[model samples]
Target: MTPKLKEDAQRLVIYIGESDRWRGKPLYAAILETLKAEGLAGATVIRGVAGFGAHSHIHTAAILRLSEDLPLIIHVIDTPEKIEHALELVRPMVREGLITLEDVRVVRYTHRYLNPLPADRLVEEVMTREVETLSPEMTVAAAWQKMLETLIKAMPVVDNSGQVLGMVTDEDLLERAGLQQRLSVAERLDKPLLDEEIARLRQSPLRVADVMSKPPITAQAREPLGLAAMRMAKHGIKRLPVLNDQGQLMGVLSRVDILRLLSEKPAMKMTAPLGATQTVRDVMTPVIPAVQQDDELPEIVEKLLESGTHRVIVLDGFGKAIGLISDSDVVARIQPSQRRGVIAALFGDALAPSSSVTAAELMSPGVLTARPETSLVQAARMMMNPKRKWLVVVDEQDKPLGLVDRHILLRALTAG
Candidate 1:
């Protein structure tokens, strides 16, 4: 029998505007603070690479043509009562913009931080150390074995200099294999193919360098959870490589980490509770999957698939996450149409040509982001108010950090 999905009347709304006149950072900070003050779960901001408004003016980040016409999207997610409370707060700021609300189902809900004792508190207290790593020169076989031994989906790739170059994960490895299979089929076909095409497939090797994602995304250990969530959503990734002050790989964070944190917390009941004082860092997953940028994509994809994770963190020469590669990202690089169709359905958009594109081609860069110190309340407000399900978390340097999903917050509330 299909179990009935425990339904909650939690509603969220997102806000967008076309002017850069406002202080984006401060606005985000304020939103987070406001949500926390009101006892909401979280909020988030999503930056757009390009956008159009009622005026039909194209907005972008080109310096010479610096289009102030760009739009900003703000998301907030919370209980029905909290949603109303948050809307009242942002009403004054709703000038020359768009605000839309959508209904969302809460799969889980809880308070991420229950105990305040020093011994039982802080992310540093619960985060895992002694993380696994990978090297560019490592063979696909060796990397695959490591993933099996460690029971992890991704690994950080480092060099002799202790610098992170990229990341490799099971997803990346799988994508490479799929690519190889496609190449092999094409080669076997009797149809006359270009010499370049034949040579590319013939020479393709399942090496770490061939599969690893370059310019990996990373985060500092001390960063907050709010920022990390935002980064994950912005990049459409599920993991963030953690680094130390020396730029050495410290560990990795994953969506599962966030979910686990939510699982450990108390579930929220129907009665409205008092405001929460916790931050994202208080609940972020300290252990993560990392890999070198130069690792073979096929090997990484294999590990990721085996580990049952959707994303991997890529590190640079300094052992810092510089880029991220998710199953969605890798799939987009290979199969654009399927990815596009899925994304379009998720966003409630028509299955048009624009919707049928890959994450690499469709994803917006220079994301609207938040820092670790940001409040969960504000994060929730951003996510709920804008009705956005995902938020990217970043450090003060605006590097990719982690992600916060509406479902994650809701789970915490339910668990509370």
Candidate 2:
């Protein structure tokens, strides 16, 4: 969404000849640039095929006079103050043309007419101030515990002087400390197995500096939020450490923070046209990973493995989503003896044997769903529930159409 212009506005029309020049550049081009540089609401340049000027000389795009100076009209509409400012700046450039002004009504304005992300919004406005930072001297064991307690997947490693040294993530711990699963999955492990994993970390001499990724990518607190979002997307990172002008750590900005900005005022009235508003269908991944409701446990595991995702949507006979089967669900719902084999199969150690058990018996029923036309903000609010990571986009018949997860939603907002 974008801010709308007042209904009472002014339209400035400048009539000029294509042959006219301003400092070796086209007069209309120079004027248009000046108006744009002045921050005018909007402008358009339309070249006429055939027309005549005040001199009464005819100009046409006919074969004989194809290079004749065609009439170009520069159209602009904005607030009264902006339009007046533009007229004052550009009027002097049109030495031999006409300029007209008239009152016009602004029927609508949307992101289609402007930038989707507000350029005026600063990074500090949305960044999390009370960031859970890690010290470079902290041991891997200590850092891991901090991440688990804070539920933060990524944390910036800083020095005693508050200078950012590097970044440590859950993936780094998993790779460097021989962890068997992600932080989320590890949290659900039994006490004995969890203690065994912790003991392995305690035995290692690795510190945050040893495992953290150095030369950290960061954003300035004063930079535009849009630019920071772009930096995250360009680097394919989940979050960035925000720093002040002094080069000291200030805060952190994550994908979740950017997504929350989209729905900051969800209840605010949306005045944009229907086509201008983004919907689930605009960003959802159409290729959904799914399995039949009656699929055997082995088949479900195969689908999960093939999809390279933690969860798979379960569909009924009519291809309607009814439930979901996640890796955690498999470990929690299945018999104790089958858990090891299922986990091993998911890691491609071996394929689980087909059993009479069906997906319907293992899957968590009543999945979250959204329609193709559901607004992006609405989708965000619905996904605010901590347990709802993915939203199954469905048709009117409740059949699966696509999938919308946190990453996809974040990508859409960042793209703005």
Candidate 3:
């Protein structure tokens, strides 16, 4: 049963014809859904027995034939701000109806148990207090140095007053730091783009102001950590710049920060609610050692056992992945012996795959993969079905870029 609102709380009463609909959904249902989705405290939908509108057309639910135009009232009792926001959203939905607001003190508002701790834990609790901020005038080369030294994926581009103006990431630096500018001095490296040449190119004069992703979407430190996690995932960011009410940078919240916290929480569960808007890249293990398709079974098995990967990518001569061999395939193939099942435990499903019978003989015909940008939620769903233990993170050409497993989903859930 739905909980009752306390006596004397602000209530938004929306009256619309039962037949009214916005975007094909019944107006009452649409509004109620919106209110609930928006996390409003409580809402109720009432149907009138008899009523007449501005058109003077009488409507009644007393009989089935005339029920079409019955008066439908949606009662939403919450904070004033929520009611006002919901009112604006309902305005365009009810093309022709009456809406009213009243001050009713809610003495019995309920459903408290549903939320573990709404707005109880602020972002400041889990945010990294020490932030490595970037200045608009800081050279891309300088920023790259910091990124590599700290191994932090992103940093906020802030003004002298500490107000965030933009955000810069390693990818932003890699692309704009002149690394792709053909060795800067050597039009095209007659040799290869070596570490030295790349370093020289990175020393170019491009500034953070020129390369950062500007007009960054930010979050307030006082808000719930879940809100910050949602913003990060929704925007496909690994971390968010924590800001004060004055819009000044305060700290940074990262997937790792949240993950470490969540992983330590004894109450944390894989099903814990969280925003999975963060991409696979946030948690993916970027480097998974690979083996050729023809690599022998014993050698591959040994590698899978030691590498701690359930499946390994089988690459062709050109380094293009052709297939995958998993520990499951090995378990299914090997003539069972009395020896303990150590390999099975090591792989947990190998965690990254083949042996003769050869990698070609044991591999799953087509390797399942996910892109770096795939949302964690979507990736979780993809990884969950078909009993897949893990997914190979791939690039545009289906080149193996990394690997993501069930742990990724767990981290995403807890980060919220």
Best by lDDT: 2
- Model 3 misplacement above 4 A: 1-119, 180-199, 268-416
The CA-based lDDT of model 3 is what?
Answer: 0.67
lDDT of each: 0.55, 0.81, 0.67
Model 1 alpha-carbon miss at residue 415, Å: 18
Candidate 1: tens digits of C-alpha lDDT, residues 1-416: 11112356455555555453335654545666767676666666777777787677777877775646556677776667667778888766565566677778877444434322122233333345667888887766566546645667677788877677788886676476322222212223232332333345345456677689989887677766555655655676767777777877777766555545644444455433333445555444444555556655444454445544455556555554556565455434545334434333322243322322322232222233456665555566565444454555667655556655555554333233
RMSD of each: 22.5, 11.5, 16.3
The better candidate by TM-score, 1 or 3, is 3
Q: Write the per-residue lDDT of candidate 2 for residues 10-120, one digit (tens) a residue.
A: 999999999999999989889878876676766899989898889999999888887899999999998898888888898788899999999999885445312344545
lDDT of 3 by residue, 318-339 (tens): 7777887765565555444411
Model 1's number of clashes is 122
TM-score of each: 0.35, 0.71, 0.42
